[model samples]
Target: LAKTKPIKRFNSPLRKAAALFKELHANNGSKIIARSTTQDRMTKSAEYFLAGFFGLEWPTNVTLLLAIEDSTGVWNNSLAGYYNCNNSNNYRSAGGNNATIEWYETYLADATARLQKLAPGFGWTPKDSYDAQSLCAYETVAYGYSQFCGLFTYEEWQGYEYSIDIQFAGNNAFQSPTGRAVGIGYVQEVLARLQHHTIDSPIAQINVTLDNNTATFPLDQSLNFDFSHDTNIMSILTAFGFTQFAQFLPSDRIVPHELVVSHLEPFAARLDIEIINAPAPVKASRNNTDLYEEGKATKYIHFILNQRTIPLHRSFPDCEERDDGWCELDIFLAVQSKSFEISQYDWACNGDYEAVPYGEVTNGVPTQTSS
Candidate 1:
C-alpha cells in the first residue's frame, strides 16, 4: 500500500491577509500603525495578524495600541465607539435586532409549524426556527458540518440573508439614529492620517488623549490597520456617506438594495482604502485591466470592501467617473471633509431628542433633531 502524504495545516485568514500586505511592503512593520479594542478576541486578532505581517516575533517590530472598550468611562475608543455612545446602546441601536425579529416572524411562520410537526411532542416557535437556522450557520463555521443546514430551501436561505440585512440596516447602517455618531471617530482618525495631522479636538468617540500624542497616533505612517466590530464597520460605511446603502428596507419583504450584511460584514470582513498613484490617469479596459489615459500623474483613492470594489462615484458627486472605481484623492478628501458636519455626532448621540420611526430616519440621523 502506498503511504499517504502528510496533511498540512491551512493558512489562517489573518496570516493570509498579512502575507498579502507583506508582499507589497516587506519588513516594514515598524512603519505600520495598528490598533484594536482591549477585548481579548480583538487583541488576540491583532497579535495573530501582526505575527503574520511582521514575523513570529512581532512584538519587537511594532507596538499595538490597545483602546479601552468601556461604555461608562470618558475615554473614547474608535474601535469600540458603540460602547462610548449612550444612544448607540439605547433603544436606537436595538433597531437591528427588532428588524430581524419582525422579519423572522413573517418568513419563518410556515417553517415553525412544519418543523414542529416533524418533532411531534416538541413545541417550536418562529424564534426556535430562527435559532436553528442560526445554528446551521454557526455550526458550519465551527465544526464544518451541520444537520440543520439542509433543512432549509434556497428561498429560505435567501430569507435568512435578508433578515440579517434588515438587522444591520436598522441597527447600524443608515436607519440607525446613532449610526454616524458611532463611527465618526474612526473616520476622523483616518482623515487625520491622510492629511498628516493629529486630531486636535475631541469629536464623538475619538480618544483625544491618544490622538493628541504623536507616539500613540502617528500621522506619518503609510499603512494603518484598525481592528473593529462588524456593526461598527457598517456604521463607518454609513458615516462615510456611502449612500448606496441608504435605501429604506421593509420588514415585510426583501427589497432591491446594496445593503447586504452577510456580504458586507461577514466573518473576518475587511475594508481597504488604497491611495494609488499612477503615472497618468488610468481607466479599466474591456477586459478590466487598467490602462493609461491622457493626463498628468495623479493620486487616486480606491475602496475595496470584502474583495469587492465600492464605486465612489455612486456616493459622491464630486468623485469623477472611472472604470476602475477610483476617485481622485483630492476629490475624495474634499467629499469626506464634510463627513463630521454630516454626522452631527454631538447632537445625534447626546442631544435630547425623540427617536423617529424606523424608516423615517434613513440617513443615520433623525431629521427633526438634526440641524
Candidate 2:
C-alpha cells in the first residue's frame, strides 16, 4: 500500500486500508505479506499500518520484511532496480532522463535565478532544487509542517513540483524508452506470484523466495503488501503499460501540469489491485448457433489508485471492458505471462546494449530504439 508518512493526519488512510484488509481476509487464514525498503521512513510507515491492523501499540511481533539493501549498484533486489542499473542512459546524474533535466532547467530558470535574491546567498543547482523540494515534503510530513515550506513562494513550489514530475516521467515511465525495462524484474515476480510458480529471472538470485511454501512467500495469501520508493511504483506502472501517464515533452517551454508527482506518489500514494469473483457473462458462440458458458462465475481484476478506480484503456486479449476497470483473471495472467516470457532480465540489464536502449528488449523483440 502506498501511504503517507506515519504522522497522525495520515493515519486515517492506513486505518481504512487495514479495515478493508481485515474485512476481506480476516477469516481466510491468509497471511499478511509486509515488505518495505530499507529506509527508516518507509519502515516506520509499515510499522504504523501494522499497528492499525493488530490494534497493538508497537506491533513488534509483526514481522516486517526489509527487501532492498542500502548499497549502491546492487541488482539483488528488483524493488530497487533503478539503483541497481544506475548507469543506464535512462537517467541523468542529477536523476531522470536528458529531457527531464532539460525541462527542469527550462522551467526552474526564473525561480532559480531569483533564489539568490529571495533567500539570500542560496545558490540553486538542479540537484539543490531537487533536494530542497524533497526536504519540504520530508519536513512537512515529519512535523505536520515545515520551516522550509515557507522559504519558497507558491509559484516556486509549483515549479519544484513540475521538476519532480519531469524526473519521474523521464526515468520511470514510457516517455523514456528504458523506463519500463527497469521494472521488468518486478513484473516477472508479480506474474510468478499470480501463477503460484517460481520466478526464473535473476531477481530470484537475491534470496527472495516465492516457492509457495515459505512463510514469507506463501502462495495462498489473499493480500500481498510491498513498500518501496516512488521510483519502483512508477516503474511498475510503466511496465504494465499504463499509458495514461506516458506524457511526452513537446518542447522545453511546455510544462506538463497534468503530470504531477504529488498526486501520483505523494506522501501516502497507494495502488491497489483487487481480484474479485463475479458471475460470468453469457455469450453466443462464434457460429451463433450455440451458447457458451464455461462456468457459473469468473474472476476479474480491477485496479485502485489512491482510492480512485482508474479504468483500463488497454489490457490483455479477450478482456471485456467495464466502467470499474475490471478485466478477466485469465486474460490478465496471460498478459503478464507474455511479458515474463519476453523479458530477458540478465541480457537486458547486463548484456550488450550497443544496438538497443537498456530495458527495451522483450523476448528478443525491441520495444524501442536506441537514442
Candidate 3:
C-alpha cells in the first residue's frame, strides 16, 4: 500500500486483444471465444471516440472508417425523396420545390459514408450530374413539381424553388403508390438579382397573419388566393370562412393575427424545411396525392417554383430549396420593410395557404459593413 506503481507491461494491438480476452474469460463466460479461435479486432468506440477525445473532426474520421469498414454494408432505398448517391446507375431525383445543392451534397456525403461503410465496394456519388443527351432531360428542364433552373449544370446563380401541397384527408389514397389529387397551394423562388435590381423594389403586397411568432396560412381546402391574380384572392379567403381578411391584415410587424384552418388532409405535408432569415415558403395544396411518390399536385407546383430568383449576387446567384416543407415560419426583419410580399411565379395560391418559411434576423437590426 505504501508504493503504488503504474501498470504498463507492454502495449500493442495483440496486448489490447489479450487484455479484453482475459477480462471476458475471467468473467466466467464461454461466450467470449468463437470457433475461429480469434475475434475480429475493433479498437475505436463508435469510431467517434477518437475524434472527440483528440479534438479531431468526426466527419473526416468517420469517412476514413467507412472507407475501410466493409465493401457493401447497406443502402437504404426506404428513405422517401432521397437521391441514391450510392447507385450512380440511376439518378436519385426528388421532384418537389427545393434548392439547397450544398445541403443535398452534405446529406449525400454523410449518407454515402454510412453506405460505403456498410458496403465497401459500392462507391457513392451525387446524381447532380447532367446527362449528355436530351433524352436524359425530362420534357421540361423542370419536371413534375420540380422547379430547378440549373439542375442540368453547375451554374453559380442557379434557381431554387419550394412549395407545399395539401389535399382532403379522404383523398389520401387515390393514386398509384397511393393515388390522390394534388394542387399547388404555394410556391417560392430564389435566384440572383437583376443587373440593376436591389433586394428591394415595388413590394408585392402580401397580407401576413402573425400568430404567436409565426405567419398564418388560410384554412380553406380549395380557395384560390392567387397573389398573382385578384379575383382568386377573395375566393380563397371566402373558402376559409373569413368574414373579411382585410380586418386581420397585419399592420405592424408584430400584430396578433391568426389564420383560420379551413380543411384537414393527410396530403398536407412539409417538404424541405429551412428556417432562415430569408422568406420561408409554406404549403397550400389544391388536391391530395401520394406521399411516397411525387404526384401531379406537387409536380405542378414544383414546375412553377423555379421561375423566380432571390437576387443573390449581380452575376452569381445563391439558390435555395426547402425540400421538406414547413409550418411555423419566423422572420428576423433585415431592413424591416413596411410589409412583405408574396410571389406566385406561376403557380398562384388560392384558398390553400402560401407564405415563406419564417425566421428573424440573427443579430437584431441590420448593420452596415464596408467592402
Candidate 4:
C-alpha cells in the first residue's frame, strides 16, 4: 500500500493545460469534446481540465466522454486496440514484452542487485525497481519529496529513467515494424473531422459526424480536447512519422541524451494541433519584375507537442521547408487521408503485417510508399 493517500491539487499540470487552452481560444465560446480511456485517473483528468478551462466547480455543464477499453467492442476505444487486437504483428504478439524485459535486465541489472543488497529482504525485482521509480515520481509531486527517492543515487535515477524509455520503445512505440497501426483509427478521425466527413474506420465507431453541429461535433470549434493514456499519445505520434519516438535498443546506448519518457509522458502531457487562417502567397509578374502578394486567407494546420511547435518534415507536399510546421489545411487533409485509405483495421489489428506499410511524407506530401 505504497499509495496510501490520494494526491489532490487544484493547480496541477492539468490546470496549466486548461489555462493554455483558454488563452488560445479566448472569447470564442468554444465547446470542448473531452474524451479519455475508461480509467478513473484519465476520466478525472478530463474533469479537472473542464474545471480549469471554465473556471467552475464540479457538476459543470461540460460533458466527459468515455468508451469501453476494447478494440472490437461497439464503443470506440482506439487506445486499447493494440491490446485487444488479434494481430500477431502487434506488440504483445511480437517481441515487445521480451525486448522490454531484455532491456530492463541489461540496464538495471547491476543497480537492482545493488539495491537488493542495500535493502536486504526487499528482494529487489524489476517490478520493485519500476515501483520505486513510480513512487519517487508520485511522492515527489504529491508530497514534495519521497523516501524512495533517497534509495537511488543520481546515476541510478538516470538509469531508472532510461529503463522506462526502453519499456515504452519496446512495448508501445515501434514495438514491431507496424507498431504505429494502433493509432491509425485516431489519425483517421482527425482527418475526418478536419474534412467534415464521417469516420470511415470501423475500429473508431465514433457516432458523431463533423457536420458543424455544435451539439455533437462542431466544425467551427476553435479547440478540441482529448485526454488519453501515454501509450495512445505515443501511438498517435508514431502514426504521424515522428522519428523522435523511434524505438532504441540497449545496444544503441541511447541514454543520458535520448528520449526521456518522464518529459514526454509526464503527469499531464498535451498534444495540440492548431488550425489558423492566414493569407496565401501569390506570385505576380509586373514589368519584368516578379512581385509576391498576399492572397486571400486560407486555413493551415500546425502541431504542438507539450507546448512546443513540432516541425513537420518536408516530405509532406504541403510542408514547405519552413521552421514552422504549418501545412495548408486542404493539403494536410489530403496527406492524412492517405493513411486512412491504407489502414485496414482488421488487418492491422489482426497481425496482417503485409497489408501495406504505414505511410510517410514524401516529396512534400504523403505517398502510398512506406518509409
Candidate 5:
C-alpha cells in the first residue's frame, strides 16, 4: 500500500509557512507599509479564485493571513490586506541557499507536538513554556499579525501577547524587545476546557454538561456552541454535538457524507481523519477496522460527542443511517466576514458560511470587539 508521496507544490506546509514568515522578516526591522481597512480588497481574480479544487487551492488561508499581517502586523487601508510577503516564486524565506532553511523550524516541531498532545484532549491548558520541541513563530505589530495567542487553544490573552515589533508606528516600541516569550508562540498553556455542562449534576448523566448558553444534545434541543472559538472548542461543542453548523451555508443546503473510523492518527501528533469509509479512497484501516461495526457514513448532525481523547480511537455507534463504515469526517469551519474585535480580521473565510462580524456574543466571550 505504499503510496503517500503527494507533497510538493513549492513543497508546502504553506510553502514552509511562507518561507518562515518571510525569513522572520529578514532578520529584523522596517519593511512595514500596509494599509487595508476593508473593501473587497483583491476583487477575486486569479482565474476567479481557481474555481473549486484538488488542484491550485494553495492559499493556506491566504498565506496564513498574510503571514499574520506582514511577518508581524500593520496595513488595513480599509482592508487592502497585507501580512508580509517576499514569495520568491511562491515562498522563499531567508532567500534560500537551502540546507533545510529552518522550514518553519520543522513546522514548529510539528506544530509543537500537536500543540501538546491535542491540547489536553481538546480543552488545552498545557504550557510549561512550550516544548514538545517548540518553535512557533508570529508576534508582530505596526498593526498587522501581532495576535500571539489563542489560535485553537493556549490563551494568555493580552491581545494575546507575542508582538515583538522592532519599533513603533502603530503598536509602539521596538528594536530588540525579543519579548513575547522569546519571539512569539507563547502557547498560553493551551486552553479549551469549556466544561459548562449546565449542572444537571451527575455531570449530566452520560457525561452531558455543556453550557455557554447550552448544548448537551442527543438532538432534542440545545445547540449553539461557538464559545467564541475557544474554551476547548466550547468544550468539544459541549461534548460532540455537531457534524455541521458552519453557520450560514452557501452551497447546496450543504450536506456531505463519508465517515470511516478506526483512527487515533499516527499516535504522536495524531490527525488522520476523513470518513466515508470508502465508496472510494481506502487504506490505513486503523488496526484492521470495525471502528464500531466497520466505519464510513454521511449526512451529519448526529451525536454522542466526546471529541479528542488523545485521538483515542473508536466511535461509530451513534448512528443515523449510512453506516457502510460511516463517513463525513471532513469536520468544517468557515466564517469570515470580519470581526475578532475588529482586527485579527475575522479570519477571512472567503470560502463561505457566514458569521464574520463576531462582535456581540458577550457573556459567552466571542469578544474580539473593541474597535
Candidate 6:
C-alpha cells in the first residue's frame, strides 16, 4: 500500500499541492473531484493525496472515483488508456524496448568490459550491467538503497537515464503509433471542461457513460484531480501538442533535448494546469525581471509539470510569448480544440494503415499511407 511505502512520505510535492489548495482557501471539499484507476497503486496514491487535501476522513469529504483498468476492450478509461488501445498492446509497441536495447549495446560496452575484468569468470555481459542499473533503481524504491548504485559512474548513470528516455519516447511519446490515440480521451475531456459542455459523443477513448452525464463529469468544478501512470502522462503531453518533447531521441547518443522522462514523469510526478485571472493583458518584461505589464488579460493558462513551468509559446505558436510562461486561456483552448483532429485517434487506433517504421514518426501522429 502507498500509505506504508517509505517513498510516499518522501513525496513532498503531493503534500505541497495540498498546502497550496489550503492557501488558496479552496475548502469546499464537496466541489473537488478526484479520479483514479482501479489499480491498487493509483487508488492508494489518490487516497493519500486526498487525505492531505481534505483530511484523514477523506471519503466522507470527497468521493474517490475509480475507472476500470481491464484489457477486455469493453470499457474506456482515460486514466488507463493503453488498455483500451489495442494497437498499444501488440508487438509493434516494442519499439521503445528495441531502441533501449540498441542504446544499451552502445553505451554499456565499456562498463561491461570493466565490470567483467573485476571478476574474470563470472561471464558478465552488457545485459548484466543493464540489469545492475535496473536493480539500482528498483531496489532503491523497494529497499531504500542498493549496492548496485555505486558500481556505475556519473556518466554511466546519465546513459541509464537516456536509455529510459528513449524507451518512453518510442513506447508512449511521439515515436509510438498509438501515443496520441491513447491520450486523446483525456485531452478531449479537458477541452470539454474548458469549453463548458458535456461530451456529446464518444469520439476518442473517453468513457461516454461518465462523460455524457453531468454528475460524475461536472464542467464547473474549480479543482480536478486525476491519477495516471507515467506512460499515459507522456502520451497525454504529446496529445496536447506539447511539441517540445517531439524531438527524436537517438539510441546512438544522448542529444541535447528537453524530453527527459525522469524529469517529466518520475514517480509521483504532478502536472498542474492553472487558470489565472488578470485584470489587464500582460507582456514580457523588458529586462526579464517579471515586471508587470500595464494591463492584464482577462484570463491566462499556466502549465507546471513537476514544479517547472512549461513555456506555452515554446510548443504552441499560437500562444504569444510571455515572461510568466502563461498563454491566453482562449488561445490555449483553441490550440487544444484542434488537437483531437490532429491526433487522428480513430485511424491511429483502429485503421488498417501500415505501421510506420520506428523513429520515422516524431509528432505523436502517424503519417497517411499512400494509396
Q: Each model's C-alpha lDDT?
A: 0.81, 0.58, 0.21, 0.56, 0.22, 0.81
Q: Candidate 5 lDDT, tens digit per residue, 51-114?
A: 2311254343122111111323232111111121111112111111121112223224434565
| Candidate 2 lDDT, 147-255, residue by residue in tens | 6677667776766667667667655665444456567666766666666776433452233453233566545565667766687777777766666676553325545
| Model 4: colliding residue pairs | 87-350, 87-351, 315-364, 316-364, 316-365, 317-364, 317-365
**lDDT tens digits, residue span 1-371, model 1:** 00111112237978754554544444344554579988898999889988986789877767889998776846789888887778877776677778789889999888988899899888888999999999999999999999998877788899999998988888898989888888888888888877778987878888889999888998666566789999999999999999988898899898888898888999888898877766776664436544667988877788999889999999988887667788888888898989989988888887777766677788897566654
For each candidate in turn, give its C-alpha RMSD to the true structure in angstroms.
7.4, 7.5, 27.5, 9.3, 22.9, 6.0
Each candidate structure's count of clashing pairs: 0, 4, 61, 7, 66, 6
Candidate 6 per-residue lDDT, tens place, 143-238, comes to 999999999989999999999999999889889887888898998888788778888787778898888987888765667788999999899998
By TM-score: ranked, best first = 6, 1, 2, 4, 5, 3
TM-score of the candidate numbered 4? 0.74
- In model 2, the runs with Cα more than 4 Å from the true position are 1-23, 27-31, 57-62, 68-75, 83-97, 118-134, 147-153, 200-213, 255-258, 282-295, 315-318, 341-344, 352-371
Residues 1-371, model 3: lDDT tens digits: 00111122447979965654343224232111100001122223323333552246534322221112222312211011011112111111111112223334433444445445756675544333211112233434335434333333332112111011111111111100011101111111111010112222211111121111111221211111111111122222222112222122111122332221121111111111121211222223314442233322111111111222212121111212334321222111121111112112111211122222111111111111212
Alpha-carbon lDDT of model 1: 0.81
Model 1 TM-score, 2 decimals? 0.88
Taking all chains together, the TM-score of candidate 6 against the true structure is 0.88
Q: Write candidate 4's Cα lDDT for 1-371 as tens digits.
A: 00001112247789965555455555255344556667778777877887886667534445565756654444555555454445523433334455455555665667688788988987789667767777988899999999988877786676667766765655456544334565666676676567655543244334343222445544444556677778667666766656555534462244443346777777788887876554444232234333335676566677777777776654364566444666666766666766644443444454333422221211111122332
Candidate 4: residue 75 lDDT (0-100) = 51
Q: By lDDT, highest first, what's the ranking?
A: 1, 6, 2, 4, 5, 3
